[model samples]
Target: MPKVTFVQMDGAEHAVKVAAGTTVLEAAKANDLPMVGTCGGSMVCATCHVKICAADRARLPPPTEDEEDTLDLAFGVTADSRLGCQIELTDALEGIRIQLTSTM
Candidate 1:
């Protein structure tokens, strides 16, 4: 399993350990985070958007064009922003931190 941290808007943090290869969106949903995850990793929506920690950015691959397009509909997107559905958990990514983006 790989452990990841999710930061809330108010700076609260939650740690989740998930099996390797599980997507961030899946982990979040499993943990009952307040995410919409409306598209269920279909790559058609940005409801699962999150901001990767600057130091952990290298552990993730660049987002696909489809992800970028969906993110255009997200709120408060930044250069570090990525769709959680596209990020797979792995041992190499242990301790990766990501903050949930505001849905406002």
Candidate 2:
């Protein structure tokens, strides 16, 4: 299991042990975090937008073309912005920290 940290828009952080193969959005939903995976990990909705911490950015695979296109419609697209639904948990993602964007 990977111990991942999700930082809420309010600057609060929650850490959880996530099983391998789980998407970041799944972990957030399971932990009651604020990510709204409206499109259910289909890369259609940008509701699960998040900013990957600089330190963990390189640990993830680059977003797909569809994900990148969807992110362009997101609220706060940054250099590290990514859709949580597209980030799969793996051994390499242990201790990964991502901040929830203000989608409201």
Pick the lDDT winner: 2
Candidate 1, position 36, lDDT: 77
Candidate 1 residue lDDT tens string, 1-104: 99899898889899989999999899988998867788888978789999997789987888888889999999888999999999999999999997987766
Candidate 1: stretches off by over 4 Å: none
lDDT of 2 by residue, 1-104 (tens): 99998998788989899899999999999998888889898888799999997779888888888889999889879999999999999988999998998876
TM-score of each candidate structure, all chains considered together: 0.94, 0.96
Clashing pairs in 2: none
What TM-score, to 2 decimals, does candidate 2 have? 0.96
What C-alpha lDDT values do all the predictions have? 0.88, 0.90
lDDT value, candidate 1, whole model: 0.88
After superposition on all CA atoms, what RMSD does each candidate show versus the true structure?
1.0, 0.8
